[model samples]
Target: MMRVSLSGARGLMLISTLLLSTTAFAAPDATKIANSVVASLQAKGGTKASFDSAAANGDDVVITNLKISNEGSEATVPSVVIASPVERTPGGFTAKSIAFDAGKVVDGDQTISWKTGISNDAIVPDPSEMHSTAKITPFSHFEIAGISVVNKSAPDPVTVDSVTFDLGNVIDGAPNDGKLAISGINVPGSVLKSAGQGASTLTDLGYDSLLLNIGVDGGYDSAKNALTINGITVDGKDIGKLAIGGTFGGLPREKLQNADQLKELAPTATLEVASIRYDDAGLTNRLLDMQAKQLGAKREDLVAMVPGFLPLAFSQVNITDEAFKTQVSDAVSAFLKDPKSLSIKFAPTAPVLLMDVSKAAMVNPNGVISLLGVGVSANN
Candidate 1:
C-alpha cells in the first residue's frame, strides 16, 4: 500500500498546479483572434464576408474559401492560416500576421480575374478608444502577365498584347527599418501609337523592337512626410534611355485616410535628369518619316528640309549639329547595326508644386523642367 506523509502530499499538489499554469499560458487563442480581424473589416459597411471552414490547429487558425467584398470587386482566397500571439502593448492588444495566402480579384462580370497576388498584412486598431489613426502594416506582391483592357461595347474590341508589371519586394518597417525596392512596367512601342483608336500621319513609322521599360526605387518616410525617388530609369531599348530622380514632401496627416483630402495638399518637389542617352540617327529618321507624311512628300526629300527646321522646332533650347544631313543618316545607320547614344540633361531652377503641374504641363513656363541641353548628331 502507498503510505503518504502530510509534507509529501503538499509537494504533490504543488507540482499539479504548476503543470496546469504552464499549459494555460503556452499559446494564445488563435481562432478567436482571427474571428475578430475578419469581423472588423466587414464592419466597414458595403462588405460581405464568409469563410468555408475555420479551425484552430496548433497556434494557427486555418481558413478556406475565404471570400470578402463579393459584390463590386471580389476577392477569392483559396486558403489562409494566421497565428498571432496576442501581445498587449502601450496601444492595447495588437495582433498582426506575417501569414498570408495567394488570392485573385475577380471583376464584376466574372469574365476576367487578376491572379498572382501575395499578401502578408497586419491591422492594428486604435486601442486608445480615440481611433485616430490607421496603424496598417502592408506587404504585397503582384505579377501580372499579358494584361488586356477590353471595351466590350465597341464593335471591334481593342486588344493590346504582351503587357506586364510587377512589384518585387516591400517591407512594413515598424519598430525597425523598412525597405522598398524594384518595381517596373514594360510595353511595346506599337501600343502607344495605336492607343488613339484612329490612326493617321505616323502609321508608317515601323519600330517593332522598340520597348518602354521604366523601373522605380525609393524610400517613403512616413514620420517626416517625405518620399524620395532614389532612381527612375526609362529604357527605350534601341532608341535610348533616360534616368530621373527627386523628392516630394508636404504630406497631410489628416488626409491619409480620406480620398477627398488628396486634392487639398500641394506637394513641393524638385527633379533633375541624371542622364539621357539616345541613338542619334534613329531619332532623326523617326522624325523625318513623320514630317514626310505630314507634308505629303517622300522620306528622301524631307530629310534635308527637316534638319533646316530642327533648331527652330527645338527653339526652347540650344541644339548643336556639325554636319546635320550626313549625321542623321550616319546615326540611322549606326543604330540600325547596333545601339548608340547621345547625351541630355534637365535641371529646373525652382521647386514645383504638384497642383500647378496640370496647367504648366505643356509649356513649363516656370522653367520647372529646364532643358539644360541635349546633344544628338550623326557625327557623334
Candidate 2:
C-alpha cells in the first residue's frame, strides 16, 4: 500500500478548481448538462469508480454502477434517466430529470452501466481510492448540439458533447496494481481541416471518437512480486486504430540483490502498437506541428528547415494522396518514440502539449528536424 497524503486544503482547492473548470459549459440548464455529461460517460463502456478498504480503515464505503439513458430529438429532447448503483458510500447521492429544448428534435438514445471493486492495501492510498468501481454501458442514438472551433477556416459546423477523464484504480493489496482508462472522448472536426499543426502534434489533432482501455488482473502475491495489465486498445474512425500489450514492475522501495533476482521479481512488460491508420491528413499535420512547437521550434521553421536537413522531409512535406499514409505513419512513430515529459514551476494561459525532443529527434531518420527542446507545460 502506497499512501499519498493530501497536500492540504490548498490541494483540495486546486483539485476542485481543475474539476470545475474542465467540466464547465455554457448551457441554459446547467443541471441538465451535467446529467447529460455523466450519462454520456456511462454509455461509452469504460467509466470506472473504485474504493479502498485500507484507506478508510475498513469503513464501509459503497461503490455503485452508473447508468444513463437518452431519448427524443434535438428540439424536444427528453430528460436523461440516471440509475443509481447497488453499493452505497459516504456522501452518496443520485438525481434524474428531463431538460426540454423548444422546437428542436434532438432524437437520440443512450444506456450505460458500471461496476465497483475495493482495494486491499494497508498503506496510505492515493485520493483515487475513495470509490470501489463503476462501469458505464453505452449511449444509443446520440448527437451533439453545439459547433466546435477547430481552425480559422470555417467548415461544416457540428454540435459536440465530449467526456474527459483522469482516473486511477488500485487492485487488491499491491500499490502498482493500478489502472487508468479514458473514454467518451471526441475531437472537433474542424481541427481535421488544418494541415500544418495536425501533421506535427498528436494533441492538436481532432478525432471523431477515441477510447483508452486498460485493466489489472491477478491476485496479490508478495512472494511472486508480480502483476499484469491486460493491454491497451484505442479505437476510432478518425484516428485509425491501435492496440498494445505491456507489463510494469519496479518497486523502488524494495531492495533486490541482483539483475537476475530483479528480472524474476520485476519483469519488463511489452507495449506493442499493433495497428495504425492515418487517414486524417490535415489533422495529422497539425498534430506534428504542435509537437514541434512544444520542442521550442516554430512550426514554419521546422517545415522550412526539414528540406535542408532531412531527406524524408523533401519527400514527405506535401500532403498528397500518394504520400499521406507514409507521412502519417512517420508522424505517429515520431510522437510515440519522443513523447514529452517535464516538471515545471510556472503558469501560463493556454493548453500545453509536452514533448520529449531527445527521444523524438533520435528516431527521425532525416535528422533535419532535430528537437531543440522537449515537453510542453501550460497554466491554462
Candidate 3:
C-alpha cells in the first residue's frame, strides 16, 4: 500500500481504459480521427462491432459503443467520447477535454502520459484484501470534474467535483525522490447521508471541502515509503469540526493484500487528531436526532430513551463517576440545547502502533487516543 491508499484505482482503470484505446490514433480532422479510433478498436481482440461508431464535428470525434460506464463505476454506458486529434508533444500526446455523463476533464497539457497509468492492469488475488501490485507511474498533471459515480455496492452515488494530481517528475524514481501535489477532492455531505445514518450516533455532517496543499499554498512534499492518509477534516454545520492526520509505516505491498494482516501492521502506524471541536448543545441535539433516526423514534421520545441506554454503554467501559458523568452528561445536554464549544487535541510524544491505541481506547480512552500521533506529517 502506498501513501494515501488509492484503493479505487482498479475501478477507475476499468473505465479509463475504454477511453485510452483511442490513444494510438491521431489525425488533423475529426472525421479522420474517428476513423482511426474505430479502426483501432476493431483491431483489438474485439470491440463490439455493433457498439462502435464515430461522428465528427470539426477537430473532435464523437464516439460511441466504447462499452464503458456513464457513471464512473458501472460498465453500462453509451460512452460518448470527444477526443481532440492527438497533437504531438515533447514527450506524449495530450489527453484533452473528454466528456461523458455530465462532466468534462481537461486532464493535463503536459508530456509523458501512459494508458496504463489511467487503466488498471493488475490481477486481484483476494476479493477482500484491497491491494494492487505496487507500481508508480507519475503524470505531469491530471484533472477530472463533475463525475457522479454510482458505486452499486454502496448506498449512494459518490459525486466528485474535481480531482487533480501532479506527481512532479524527479531525476530519480526513489521512494522519497519525487513529490505528489494533489487537491480538489471535494466530497459533499449528500454522499454521507446514507453512510451517516449509521454514524448518526455522532452528528449530522454537512458539506465540507478538504484541501491538502489546498489549505497551505502550493503544497507538495517528498514521498514516503509508508501508507499515509492525512488532511482529513469533517465539518458539521450546526455542530463543530474535526481534523485528523496519520501515517502507517512498515507496510510492504505483499502484506497489504490481505485483510488479517492489517491488524499486525496497525501497530506500526502514527496517527493523530489535530482538533475535535464541538458545540455541546449542538452536538447533543444532533446525536439525539441521529439516535432517533437510527431507532426510528421521535426526538422527544429519544430524550427519555437515550439516557437509559447510556448507563450500559458507560458501564461497559467502567465509567462509574456519577458526579463526573453528570457533569459530562449535563454539558452534553446543555450543549445540545444551546450549544457550547468544546475542543480537543491529541499529539503523541512518540510513534505507537494503531493496535495499541485501539486496545487502550477500551480502557483509558483519553490516554490511548493521544497515542495516534505520528513522528511526522504526511506532507513532510
Candidate 4:
C-alpha cells in the first residue's frame, strides 16, 4: 500500500476536474446538426426534403438517401458526409466541410449528374431566420467534379471536368471578392449537329464539336459603392478567346441580395470604362476562309473588300463618325489579314451615368459614340 500526501491528493483532484471539464465541451449532437442542414437547404430552395437515415461515423455525420424535390423536379443524393468540428451557433450551425456523394437531378426531359461536390467552411443558418440578414453565400469555397448534362433533343451529353468557386474578404454578410472557374467543357458533335442555324455557323468555322473553358474574376467594394469586373473570359481549344471587362459606380449594398434590386439599379449606375477583346487562336483564318469560299473569292480579296464596304454598313446604322468609322475599317482589315488580336474600348473623360447614356441613345444616337470615347485597334 502507498500513502498519499494531502498535496498529492489535491493534485489528483485537479486533474480529474480538468478531464471532466473537457468532456463537458464534447461535440454537439450530430443528429440535430444534420436536421438543421436539411432544414437550411429546404428553406433556401423552397423545396421539400427527406432523408433515409443520419448517423455518426467517427468524427463525421453521414446522412443517406436525401431526396429534395420541387414541382416535378427531383434531386437524389446518395449520401452527405459532414466533417468534424461542427458547432452550434446562434444563427444555426457551422462545419469544417460538407461533401456530397455522386448525385443526379431529373427535371422534365433533362437529367444532370455529377461525380461529387464539396463545400468548405459551410455555414448552415437557421431556416426560420434566413431573411433577417443579407448573408447570401453559405460556403467560402465550393467545387463539383465530373458534371454531365443530357437533354432529350440532344443526341449526346455535355460534359465538364470541374467547376469551382471561391469567396473571401467577407463584409456586411456577403463577400467582397470572388472567382469562378469552369474547365474542360466538352460539347459532343452530335449535339451540335442537332442545333440549328448557330451550329451551322460554328461548323463552318471548323468546330464540329467544341471544347471550352470559362473564368470570371470580379469584386465589389461596398465603401466606394463601386463594382468592378476584372475579367470574364471564354477560351476554346482551337478557337479564339473572347474577354470582357467593365467598372460601374454607385451600387448600394442594399441592392446586393436579390434580382429585383439589380434591375432597379442598372439604369442609374455609372460606367467608368468597359472593353471587349478577342485573341485569335485558329478561328480567324478558318472564318475568313469560309467566308471567302462562300463569296467565290480569295481570302485576300475578301479582306480588301471590307474597308470600302464599311461606310455602307455604318450608314445603315446612322453612324456618321467618319474618323471613328475609318479607324474601325482599318482595324478590321488588319485583323482579317494577319489574325492576331482585336479590341474595342470605351473610356470617357469622366464617369458617364447610365441614365445619361440612355437619354443620349434615345435623343441623339450618333452622339452617344463620341460621348463614350470609343476606340478600336488590332494586332497590338
> Which candidate should be chosen as best, given TM-score against the real structure?
4
lDDT of 2 by residue, 167-284 (tens): 2333342233333444344444443444356432443354442332222232222454333334444545444334343322332214332343555432322211111112231434
lDDT of candidate 3 over 1-380, digit per residue (tens):
65544667776887788666654432335444444434433443333323366676555556664442222322322554554545332212233445444322221221111111121111111212212332333234444444454544445444444444444333342122222333333333444444555443232432242222231112223343355444444444444444444454556544454565756666555442243444332455556666788899998776655545766876787756565456456544444444455444456665555677778877775455335431211110
lDDT of 4 by residue, 1-380 (tens): 99999999999999999887767645556678778877877886768888988887766788898898998999999998888746655656777898986998999999999998999988888877576345656789999999999998889999999999999888766788889999999998788778888876787676878999999999998887888999999999889899999988878767755566778777668999999999999998887899899999998988888788888888777888778888998899889889999999999988899989988987775788889988999998
lDDT of 1 at 267: 52
Could you tell me the lDDT of residue 123 within candidate 3? 17
- Cα RMSD, model 1: 8.0
TM-score of model 3 (CA atoms)? 0.44
Q: Number of the top candidate by lDDT?
A: 4
Each model's TM-score, in the order given?
0.56, 0.25, 0.44, 0.92
lDDT of 1 at 369: 35
Q: Which is superior by TM-score, 2 or 3?
A: 3
How does candidate 3 score on lDDT? 0.43
lDDT of 1 at 127: 32
Q: Backbone collision count in every prediction?
A: 3, 66, 6, 0
Candidate 2 achieves a global lDDT of: 0.32
What shift in Å separates residue 115 of candidate 4 from its native position after superposition? 1.1
